[model samples]
Target: MSATQMDMLWMAYGKAGAVGSIRHEDDLFHVVMSDRREIGAYPTLEIAKGALISHLKPGTDRPEFRRV
Candidate 1:
């Protein structure tokens, strides 16, 4: 797998519950949270991005998947 292929993904959260998912793509992947909740299985990372965005709030100031 190339560098673009994400081996891991996380929903980085910020103050007041802001969230956004780190994205990368490869030939195939399965996205899951730190909590181990399955984000669903997709044939491609691009296809799963919609779900990632839905679970994220891009306008926050926090580092990684933390609830500050």
Candidate 2:
């Protein structure tokens, strides 16, 4: 895969909360909330994206998924 593709994948995985450290094997990423809640496992990147999208400010740099 190209560098761009790899970056996209990493972005997807990261958005899914699958890029952080965790103890669970099934976890994609460890999400630590401001409430001190650590969500270890999540479903898919799309789901995570949906959950986070609304909370993101308008001018924030969002991750764009593209075909490489």
Root-mean-square deviation of every model: 6.4, 9.0
Q: Model 2: per-residue lDDT, tens digit, 1-68?
A: 34432322223223443222222124342333333445444455555554444344476455443222
Q: What is model 1's C-alpha RMSD?
A: 6.4
TM-score, every prediction: 0.38, 0.31
Model 2 misplaced stretches (Cα beyond 4 Å): 1-9, 12-41, 59-62, 65-68
Candidate achieving the largest lDDT: 1
Error of 2 at 66 (Å): 7.9
Who wins the TM-score comparison?
1
Model 1, 1-68: lDDT tens digits are 65644556545554544344444445444555435555766675555655654544465343345211
